[model samples]
Target: MSERYEYVPHHLLRRPVRDIATGVEGELMAVINENVSDAGREHWIELAYIRRTCGREFTTAISNVESVG
Candidate 1:
């Protein structure tokens, strides 16, 4: 399960997707906000939730996913 979730503006939730970096494919569950900083500035990172084909789940940057179909 994810720690935080947001139904991002785009219709990304509940959509099938794949992580090209890891090759894990599944449904997009949610988008979570992550705080990052560099040079005294904070940034929000959007992580997309994925339910792996093997019954596992995790969150990765939204840019890491691609439409499965």
Candidate 2:
């Protein structure tokens, strides 16, 4: 089962879903995409959330997720 997610602003969460899904879905449809695994994909989604909420450096933000968890 998936872990519970905390609530977030609608504007913050909604944009990334639409934004990331657009690229993800397009790649899935064409079937030519490469370099992103399922775990990597999930990380990117989380990265979007990090970018939206923290406005910090992507590499730095991604590194800090381990501390949060």
Candidate 3:
């Protein structure tokens, strides 16, 4: 029997995420896309969010996600 997995899109996320590079925190706005390697060993995803400090929007990958409020 084949195992089933749940797929959750990033755009639907209402939680906050911190950008690893910029150390910026914001609430998720949208998920641009998700990519997986051919071997299915690696994953890459891009997302957009609004900056909490200045109300600016930015798109980035490799961010740290925080629990939803």
Candidate 4:
């Protein structure tokens, strides 16, 4: 006599769950778990946040100063 199921922790179950454009750079967070029940129906861990950073930042410094040692 055991039948009780009420638990959902897949990053609150929903929100923008489709983004896997691979051009790898930065800002990538992922957690995926897929196991379709076989008496072990406790598997749903999917949380993904990805943003490939190519935001461009280049700084070059050139100042005339005499200091050689």
Candidate 5:
């Protein structure tokens, strides 16, 4: 990992990545840390925000993506 990547705990914004399940490729636009509650329990999640070559955007679990660049 590069020094810049080491400092960024969970994201590589603007880097290219491919979705594991869908095989869709895109630029990683953002990393989102979210909290949610269910039945009095709290959960934390990390998301990969992406923009496809066709200009569409979406968020998926960070683990679902692999860096392509």
Candidate 6:
């Protein structure tokens, strides 16, 4: 049998994050899978930031999650 998951609103999962070094605000895109690890979370944050900022990708070390909203 296959497992099913409930859908969560994008707005609810979109978190307000900031670049600690540059102070640029951005969104932390949410993870849909429940089995994500700490490293995976970090990678997702970086990918989301890059996609959102385009060529202005921030270093993973400098991005910080401010709030989930």
Cα TM-score per model: 0.70, 0.16, 0.48, 0.21, 0.75, 0.32
Residues 1-69 of candidate 4 have per-residue lDDT tens digits of: 133333323441222222324323333333333333456454432333333345432211111111122
Cα lDDT for residue 44, candidate 1: 69
Which structure is stronger by TM-score: 1 or 6?
1
Top lDDT prediction, candidate number: 1
What is candidate 5's lDDT per residue for 3-68, written digit by digit as tens?
Answer: 222112555678899988798999998777666546676666777778999999988888898998
What tens digits encode model 2's per-residue C-alpha lDDT throughout 1-69?
Answer: 233233223332223322232222110011111223454343222233333243432221211222110
TM-score leaderboard ranking: 5, 1, 3, 6, 4, 2
Local accuracy by lDDT, each model: 0.77, 0.25, 0.57, 0.30, 0.76, 0.40
Candidate 3 lDDT tens digits, 1-69: 122222347643656767667767787666554554456465545555545657787766635444344
Candidate 1 per-residue lDDT over residues 1-69, each given as its tens digit: 333334575476788898878988899878777665466765668888898778789878888889988
Candidate 1 displacement at residue 59 in angstroms: 1.5
In candidate 5, stretches whose alpha carbon ends up further than 4 angstroms from where it belongs are 1-11
Clash statistics: count for each candidate: 0, 0, 0, 0, 0, 0
Instruction: Itemize residue pairs with steric clashes in candidate 5.
Output: none
RMSD (Cα, Å) of model 2: 14.3
Candidate 4 weakest lDDT stretch, 10 residues: 58-67
Q: Which ranges of candidate 1 are over 4 A from the true structure?
A: 1-7, 37-39
